[model samples]
Target: MKLEAIPRLSLGYLPTPIEKMERLSAELGITLSVKRDDFTGFGGGGNKVRKLEYLMADAVAQGVKVLITTGGHQSNHARMTAAAARKYGMKPILVLRGNRPDLYQGNLLLDHLFGAEIDFLDPDAYFTEINPRMAHHAAEAEARDEKAYIIPLGGASALGAMGYVNAVKELSEQYAAAGTPAPRYLVAPVGSGGTLAGLHIGCSLYWPETEVVGIAVTGSAVPFSERIAVMANAGAELLDLEKRWTADDIRIENDYIGPGYSIPSDAGNAAIKLAGNREGMLLDPVYTGKAFAGIIGCVEKGSIEKGSSVLFIHCGGSPALFPYAGLLTSDLAG
Candidate 1:
């Protein structure tokens, strides 16, 4: 069960650059760098592309003709999934939360441009309705004699998490090349927990001693840290790795969410502006912005000690910025 033995498509640019954020590091009194997964370079470049490489390989193996997945209206995952499906010559069907808006912008616009079939459900219907809707799409595909593959929410399944486990391995090599020690902490945004799950396992096996912290962008009744532990173990099983994770092993910061999911938080917007103005990097409101805000919050609270080396995973969602133009412009002006 070697990771290399697993089937994966070459969908994203590998080993996205790791750049030191000197200004932010000095400002925060900690050494800070970013793993630029935002530059993954496929389907508009995001962390989802890594997960899709494995998922798409599975779909192709199963002779899938239609790919189905669920996400919010501005879901970066949905946008990337659409692109991956098209690249593999499979049809993509997205079941998104919320009613259709009069204007299609941001990732929604890209989803449409990718020529995906989309269905919008009421916001309250998301949890209860998404699975059934995806199943319905599958049944319809069956009626047409075309196979549909349903990807889980955020592509959080064990198979897809392999992408980040491999990423940790890549990071290890990069650290060695740059002659830097393993980072004191690795931070990332957690929406569905798949990426964090993979990183936990990856850090355990490839870069020991580096703690991983996930910043939750969306609140969930089901404790995502516990859920992500189970997922990491499942991925470990897939890779035949000896490391086993538990809820205690996973650390998630949930305070920075500000409001509900998809709605930009004041702190998140400020963090977005800070990153853009300081590092010339764009961070979306949904994920990376809140995650960076968490980093700032943690530093202010002394949770992350001064002079510690921290690396943030810039999981791409900058296109999501387009949809929040009004809010962001107001922040910029004020």
Candidate 2:
């Protein structure tokens, strides 16, 4: 598909390790492996680096000197984008949801460390007001003799999703080299939908037998599936591919998102602790924890076959855990 012809920035440590989780595998009675995108190693490492590698390349190609994006206060994507902007010599402006916290910790702290300009708005205002104002914000930067680029929430644009398409290819090569059978199931956390979209398209093309499942940390399955399908189709078009995706192709479980987005759920906390104790691996409550919980749920409900091989994409957000210490500690206690 001439994917190499696409322009991309050299960012992130590629071919991140795919290690088998022996303890977790035995516990679940299935072969469990982890795709450690958390080790991506740019701006404190995360899956967002994969997306930004392409998104920022597009920004730089457009001669943009400023990058603007929006997300929650502790958004891993926003944090990574800020770090990436600094690396490429572009100013980053983050329009974050919610008022400034009494104490800045976790990713919000890293945002300041990266020197990103921060503006806070109420959650409702951010979605209803600030989102539509992004172009205006960019225009204001232009008036100041600066070229600005607006990256959507979670870097979910078609261009950004190309990163995961490349990731799937990398993963296929890894499986081949290790002489391991292709996993029957691939799971990842879905927030803004781009990662799942790219994974679905890539899996369909590269490893057709594998079913990609997304654990929604926010909304319900049906609407999120539709959103992911749209992203996949758009990404296919961006790559000049003829692949078309529909909601039917997306398999997402919305039951894992307990309470609401960003609030620590009991099940998510347990998953985080389980991964920590069993595999010596860390998972953040907001994303990976809930996703892993969903994986456990799938096994319990017999959705995943007893002896099946599954690959869990660890999309990384360990830093966010620091800010939720009180909640996690209380939940884990007793």
Candidate 3:
């Protein structure tokens, strides 16, 4: 796909390790392993760092002095964006979609530690309020003779999706080094769809045999698969690849998204505990926890065949765990 032609900064630990989970594999009746993007090792380390590598490079090239983004209160993207902006010597402004908490915790605490200018809006205003508010901040920066770059929700732009496309390339090399066939299925959480879209394009190019399964963590009025297909095609266009994706090409498990976004569900919390206790892997409630639960759901429902090889992308959100400590401890306590 000529991914090397793109401008990207070295912002993460390249080629994160893939580790087999022997204990969890047996329990699930499948050969299971995880790509540890959690250890990306920058801005508190997460999947977003992969996208920011390309995004920050563009921002620097454009002489952007202020960076603005929006997300929920405990968004890992917001925390990492603030960190990336600080690392690159730019001001970060977070216009989050919620009221300010009485006490900062989890990713919110880290965002403050990074010295980001933070604003809180009503949760109901998410779709309507985020862009206009960010534009206002951009105008203010312009008045001060500073250039501002507005990164979209979760860095889901076509250019940023290149990060995960590059990641799948890394995955192909890893499997080749081990002299093993690629897994039958690749699984990951789907938030803004950039990561999934990238994986779709990447797998199409490198690991065509493997299917990518997206676990949606949020309920959206617009179908996420359609959105993801559009994103994947856009990314494919950037890579100059002839392949295009349709909504039917995307396989999404939507049942695991319980209650609402950011609300912990019984199944999700149990999955978090199972991973931590069995595999010593820590996953948060918002993203990884729900996605992990989806893996179990798929296996139980026979959607993923027994004894098949499955690889999960651990996209990282353990920082958000702190904010949910009270509920988790109460629910998971023996």
Model 1 segments more than 4 A misplaced: 331-334
Model 3 residue 210 CA deviation (Å) reads: 0.5
- What is the per-residue lDDT of model 3 for residues 82-200, given as tens digits with 9 covering 90 to 100? 99999989999999988889999999999999999998999998788889999999999999999999999889989989999999999999999999899999999988889999999
Candidate 3 residue-wise lDDT at 204? 94
TM-score of candidate 1 on Cα atoms, chains taken together: 0.98
Off by over 4 Å in 2: 220-222, 331-334
**CA RMSD per model (angstroms):** 1.0, 1.5, 1.1
Cα TM-score of candidate 2: 0.97
What's each prediction's TM-score? 0.98, 0.97, 0.98
Cα-based lDDT at residue 138, candidate 3:
98
Error of 2 at 87 (Å): 0.9
With candidate 3 superimposed using the best TM-score fit, by how many Å does residue 141's alpha carbon deviate from the native? 0.9
Please give the lDDT score at residue 286 for candidate 3: 96
> Which residue pairs show collisions in model 3?
none
Regarding TM-score, does 1 or 2 come out ahead? 1
Query: Which ranking of candidates, highest lDDT first?
Result: 3, 1, 2
